[model samples]
Target: MVRALLSRARDMLDGIPHRWGSAAIASSSASGHGAEDAVAGYVRMLGAGVRPDAYTFPSLLKAVARGAAAAAEVGGAVHAHVVKFGMESSAHAASSLIVMYAAMGDAAAARALLEACPGATGGAPPPVMWNALISGHNRSGRFDLSCRSFADMVRAGAMATPVTYVSVISACGKGKDLLLGMQVHKRVVGCGMFPDLRVGNALVDMYAECGDMDAALVLFEGMLVRSMASWTSVISGLVRSGQVDRARELFDHMPERDTVAWTVMIDGYVRVGRFREALETFRRMQFCKARADEFTMVSVITACAQLGAQETGEWARIYMGRVGIKMDIFVGNVLIDMYSKCGSIERALDVFGDMHNKDKFTWTAIILGLAVNGRGKEAIDMFYRMLKASLIPDEVTFIGVLTACTHTGLVDKGREFFLCMTEVYNISPTVVHYGCLIDVLGRAGKLKEALHTIDEMPMRPNSTIWGTLLAACRVHGNSVIGELAAERLLELDPDNSTAYILLSNMYAKSNRWKDVQRIRQVIMEKGIKKEPGCSMIEMNGIIHEFLAADRSHPMSKEIYSKLETVLIDLWNAGYVPDVTEVFVEVTEEEKQKVLYWHSEKLAIAFALLTSESNVTIRIVKNLRMCLDCHNAIKLISKLYGRKVIVRDRTRFHHFRHGSCSCKDYW
Candidate 1:
């Protein structure tokens, strides 16, 4: 029906006189129906021998700008018409032409048209023309050109309007040019254009993005009225500045909450590792009846992954389906990561398989997940599959593959991949990759080789590298290399409590009581307190946390009683406390008591008391599991005939039938 109307209009234009023909074309173009139809109507008018006037070209150019497919061709024809009529000198026609070219991502053509303007003189072009150029450059992501144009506009004595300031400020923000942004703010104030809401909001956003939170806050508080975007900018900026508490305070004070505002707050909590708070905020958002979009859901999924809240993450996935939100590649990638992190590798694989498209991140997440779960061979197989599918392996992907080799004690495979990463892939090994290699060698009892690798690294070894070596040395009882690693680690990170603790543990194992005491004294003198070990478990949609020897939960009595029973079973299974694992100079019984109160054991005890028999017990801990805890958990798994999954800071341990998925290598 629209096509019929266009045809009839064209026929009417053919019969109309020249003077009315141009008006007819202008009216048709102004209808804003469709760019193609509008251009067709103009062609009909031109065929009828009508000449385009100054006013006629602008509307035609606007119509051409609206159509992206045939825009260049139609726009060029319109340009020819402007030149033929000698109306290219008209400011209205020239500005429209410039904007049209810019809309098509042709900044070069836009500049050419601007220079061809009859009014182009020694001075700066008109502010409107300059704004069009700046807007075009800014739209095309040529931010530097946009800024330079703004400067030239100023030098030509052309006063900038609110529109001009908006584009320039946006360019400044995108370029991270705080100085230019501040100057733009000053110009806005001097012109009294700060009263403009758009100008005000842009200034605030610019300041915030440029890391000038103080300036951003000042402008934000001074605004007469605030939009959702205005509040979100400040809140997100505060979050980026690591002021999460301040961001939350502002979030609470918001008069109204939009999805973006809610997303910002939830994501802010996630950024600070406050997964519980992030989940709580997400729940509150749902209760408030605000619908979550893909961005919000992704953040919520990440929070769930961090907390191992598989139930919540599953619900979020269902919610997305219920709301008819299509899972794009980005959402799919995050889902893979979320499921993998939540200790459900099968579900993660399902998500990966279901994805219609997979990027490097998707592949990396799955491989890393499998590696951390101690499915090292599967991870390496996936890497080969990724290559077969023609996906380029990035630095992160190699890390996963190398980590797999480390977990599985495939030292030769680890070395092969390490060399391949640098030679075949031309990807330089980062400290993390080097650390993984060292871990592989060190865990295999190749202390000398590991030390040599560190010494041969292209970059200086970081604390993580030294820390990995020290951990391996402690595990294998290599006191000589362990001491050297400890010294180097301390020099790099003077207050690293983990290094001190590991070194002290190694000393204690070798009966170096005096050295252990001296290290303890240093720790005390430096006020370097160790992070208290804590473990978390999720049940019935609630997270329960337990610290060492904690008795805070209402069911603490039952948990401890269950722990006693598990300890008896462990003893029957040939379990004995490795007192040497304890770093302190204490009696053997004291060390045994200390091992009995580990946070992970307490968490498992609570799980055994509360969880159903057939279900897996999943626990997340903040620190590495001690050898005693590792041995006990393995025995508990066998005695109870239940599977237990424990994720420490470094890797996951799956215990079943008196064996670990890591094969006692980790």
Candidate 2:
């Protein structure tokens, strides 16, 4: 089959115009043939006496470079043939070798070919060849080589154009080399390469990636020619560098936003957990008739999951069905994530089951949803099923299984999966992986094990791992580990009020009143303030935000009054203020009164008062719910017979029938 295809390709190549012969070669080589078969077929062409010329090397090398498992080995043979044919010195042949080697991930060989070709001038490689080489290096994580090669192009007096500059700048982005990137920016201006859209886009991307939004905006504003890519690069960069407000401004200002621009803005909102804005932008994208690609679908699905927008997510599913998009691994994974987060794990399982093809990410997504959403036993079973199907679990898959173990308090199962990740899969644990493990141990009241896990981590622990331990300490009443975790968290992020609050709670829980007072004193001395917890719920397409003790709503008086009634009812039902959280010089009654206005409780009451009877209330919170608030939500869910979904900073809480979706673990 391969020889026949190659023979047909060679016969067709003979009839193509000389200028289009290279394209024809690339086209034929990319026709889904195996590299080994392509190689065998090419040799057969030579044996049949089809006198291979300069064009032949380009075609044959391309086939071998991308076709077979042994891409580089086969590519080297093609190079030898070119050299033997006395075409090695030809500029076309040399350029093809340069690109072929680079594409085959052998940059050294590409450089050697460039050095050996006498016909190769300083810029003889051409921009196409240079772009290929630089992009290849970037893909291979050889940022230094890419940067050095760009410099060599300039020092050798090669005319470096904007296309080439984009490749070089992107390479710097891969390296995260801010200083080197800035130096490249200087070279761009000094070499009179400004005003080029591609170069300007690269500059915007570089600065945004390096956390220099000021420079990124400056470049964006000064660009004489800005394409959609130029605008999207800056907008997306701002979003990624934690400047979401600036990103929104640019997104709103774009006179014409393509699908990429809209998707990126939605992604920015999703990243910051602002799903309402993401949904709004998605609606606007549809209004503008911009096409929703796979990425747009993913972002919208993520927003639906966070907001529990069943109607919107179902609409997306219907749209995807109508369009007949392939639902490839990424789309499938996100769909599963959406269904899982939206309190529809059955839908998540259905999507998972319907997938004709599955990759590691797909498995991980479904497993994670089940594990974290009160299906710990099912998560474990599905993981075993994955192994039965001979699918290997990567590090990400382990996190899901570990989360399942944590939620179910399956200490032994968690340890087994943790070992499987390192021993069976040979996958080294990342900080996220460690964080999940620590959470599992901490939740199980294995404080010693959680602490030991942090100490045994190969790399220095990040705030996330320590934060997990701190949260677990709160649950398990381990003051020592809680204090240690808080201290470490403060060292990593000094202004993190969550750490300070958690430490204060730890002290108060252990009856260390002086310590709690000292913590408040320290907070005052440092001029740091705890950001009030806020939750938002969407009703009739309008979002309402509620803060702790917030009285800013138009119906504030009514809302507060209704909240007081709920507090009175809960108080009669044996609810008590977990007074440790008050952290104020106030009377006991004042503290109890203050607890009634807690963000989640207020939001729940407001949602109940506004929405129709029996409607579910979905609220997104910026911080964790306190113990008292969690219990109150449980009782409210049952009393009102409403399903309340609150997505706090750490995880989701689904309250109904006097129970939570987290199974009382979170």
Which candidate number would show the highest lDDT if scored against the true structure?
1
lDDT of 1 by residue, 78-100 (tens): 66566657885788888887877
lDDT accuracy of residue 400 in candidate 1: 96
Candidate 2 residues 54-88, lDDT tens each? 77776666555554223544455566566556776
Task: Summing lDDT over every window of 10 consecutive residues in candidate 1, give the lowest-scoring window.
Answer: 1-10
Q: Would you give me the overall lDDT of model 1?
A: 0.83
Off by over 4 Å in 2: 1-224, 240-255, 271-275, 306-311, 319-326, 386-394, 430-432, 451-530, 555-558, 564-580, 612-614, 661-665
Considering only N, C-alpha and C atoms within 3 Å, which residue pairs clash in candidate 1? none
As a whole number from 0 to 100, the lDDT of residue 318 in candidate 2 is: 87
Q: Tell me how far the alpha carbon of residue 642 in candidate 2 is from the true structure, in angstroms, after superposition.
A: 2.9
Error of 2 at 658 (Å): 2.5
TM-score of each: 0.79, 0.69
Among the numbered candidates, top TM-score falls to: 1
